[model samples]
Target: MKKVAIQGGGGSNHEIAAKAYFETDNIATVECNSFEELFSTLKEDHSIYGIIAIENTLVGSILQNYTLLKDSGMVIIGEYKLRIKHQLLALPGERLEDIREVHSHPMALAQCSDFFKQYPHIKMISRDDTALSGKWIRDNQLKGMAAIAPALAAEKYNLDIIAKDIETNKRNFTRFLIISHKEKIALEDILTQQPINKSSLVFALPHAEGSLSKVLSILAFYNINLSKIQSLPVVGSEWEYLFYIDLVFEDYKRYQQSLNAIRPLTRNLKSLGEYHVGKRSFDTVSNDNKPLSEQKTF
Candidate 1:
């Protein structure tokens, strides 16, 4: 059984994505109140695995998580993209109008901003985790308080959906990274199971003219599709930045060649992961983001 450390409580999106990714395995989740705690848990026990939200299509990147993951020295073995649908959950007998305050992760609250704008009377309070907020209201039996969290959270905590799909955009999605201690993964089996088509990388470059452009040109020559690139300033380094990038390609050998071709130009270039692009094959997560069956597999 895989022991996965997830951010937020049982029914949070992290947990949902975990189950969906590891669809056929008997895995256990260690609920963490924060991403920091999630990494700490993994560091303390290298046997445990982890899944974390890297970016949300609705709210953009979870910038802090990128830094944490970089510093954590954890390996990104896989990735999952979750379709997020936020719901306003409250006590069984409560109605939307009866709620005086809504609580959730800042991102969750922000995603549902338009819905809350319709209920200006309800105060929005930020919490560390989305599902945890609902769990707290249920545990405390708090009346007139609700949480904007996932639909699975309602089922987990026995909360009522005061409002369903409350997010401002119906087309919201969040991408999560599957991380593990290097020894915990059998890289051969993972890459061999499917075509290695995508990669995540982190690196820094010398502050030289056209240094970034040179790297991009090499990748282009090798036909590597630069799926995404994010830059964060290096602390105490004058005008230097760490680039976090995602690359996609049809040929694994060509991908490696691309990396090698540009490796000399980049400083401290680290390959975070090389895996399959998340798509229909991992669609076990239903419309409500619930597991289709109790079967264990990732």
Candidate 2:
């Protein structure tokens, strides 16, 4: 069986991907308690695949995961976008009025802040995983206690959904990336090709007026389109910023040339990674191919 190491407890978002990507009978799910555990497992297990939550519509970017991916050598093999549905789950026969404390992961609690505000008397406790929180509340049989987690988690833990779609924003989505220790193949290898809609790079610009303009001009010169630009505080530097950019390039060669041209204008330039422009989707396996259970490692 192919073992996939996923972030958070067994019933978290990562398991959703595992179910979508690999056959259940041939897949082994490894639960990681924290980001640290996830990274360590990735380093130790060469054959293991990982699904990490990169960003969410309601909660914003997962900055820590971004840093982890930036520093790690693992290649992003695929991505999956899961629609987040937050549920207020509690122990059996527990009513909303009976709930005094609600526990969940920080992000989950944040996303449901508005809902929680309605019950000002209820105390909010942040835990590691939303699903794990639900499990804890269930296992402990804590009356007047609930958790914010996905419906799958509620089903797995046999908790009742006291409230549904409790997020402040109705359009909640979380983008996850599937990473592998195996080397990434050239872009040409993927058959369902899409236009290179987004290009990401990290760079430090020279501290001078028009320096930023000059860097941007390189993209303009090549007719490269930029989608988003975010400036993050540069570590150990006071008032200086490291710029992260996302661009839409017509072609890879043009993107490369644009990057090459900007090299001299910036103090430092590095391509973090490149992915095709599109919403997340899963890979399809041929029916005739051997199941993961029958496959042998070299």
Candidate 3:
């Protein structure tokens, strides 16, 4: 009976990731029309958890959400990397030839751009949510319109899959972060509950040259591996930047030591969260040769 808040409606990839991370089919969703609402919902109801897409392999980091996460004071408890397979779905009884317009999230439309090239007559329309497009088409019994979304959306919205894996790159993936109220959940408690090998951190460096390099050297000396690093310009300060990084480590104590070692070198060092690096479940191979999107349970 776990209730989680997602940025999109039911059958959205956020909900899909939540189910995978929580490992439950019974989790209820508090759907928010937008990401801003998603965080606000959690603030109003501390008991409700939240899942949000942080980054995608095809697209870059969601920079705005980083600011939201930091400002909202939510703690990242877990993460999930979902393989994004875009499917073209239409209302039942409609064929691909009958569809003239395809609707989806902008990113999804971009991913399936190559697939639509064959049908230049079909126009691509961007929407706020991929699954919402499907739900809209279904609930309204719309015709001649299709949605580019996950297969789950097709199933959930009772849409016929006109096409499967339409994304230009079969390797597309989106990394989602699971968050909760900081006061409601303790970092130590989450660390004990899960095998935390990965951590996200944000910090500001001194203006001096090699200041960032010094911090990197210290982490390398501690046997920490930098998986991802992103730099966002500081708004008020011209030419100043804040660094957000993802680190993976084998030894928890060594990782802790690395953080302590870098604190002196960083101006505002903050450990965003420490959680297990999400496994790519959609990359699994089945003996029957079925697609990973079809084989995945959730």
TM-score of each: 0.89, 0.80, 0.91
Off by over 4 Å in 3: 235-239, 284-298
Candidate 1 residue runs with Cα over 4 Å from true position = 24-26, 280-298
Cα lDDT tens digits for candidate 1, 1-298: 8899999888899888898788753679999878899899998898898999999776788888987887886888878777788899999999988999999988888888888888889999999989989999999999999998899899999999988888778667788898987766674356577777788888898889998999998998988887788778878986588898888888888999888999999888888777777641233333554331221121
Better of 1 and 2 by TM-score: 1
Off by over 4 Å in 2: 17-27, 182-197, 280-298
lDDT of 1: 0.83
lDDT of each: 0.83, 0.74, 0.85
Q: State the lDDT of candidate 2 residue by residue for 208-240, as single tens digits.
A: 888888888879988887755777777788537
Q: What's the CA error at residue 264 for candidate 1, in Å?
A: 1.7
lDDT of 1 at 175: 86
Q: Residue 106, candidate 3: how far off, in angstroms?
A: 0.8
TM-score for candidate 2, please give it.
0.80
lDDT of 3: 0.85
Sort order, lDDT high to low: 3, 1, 2
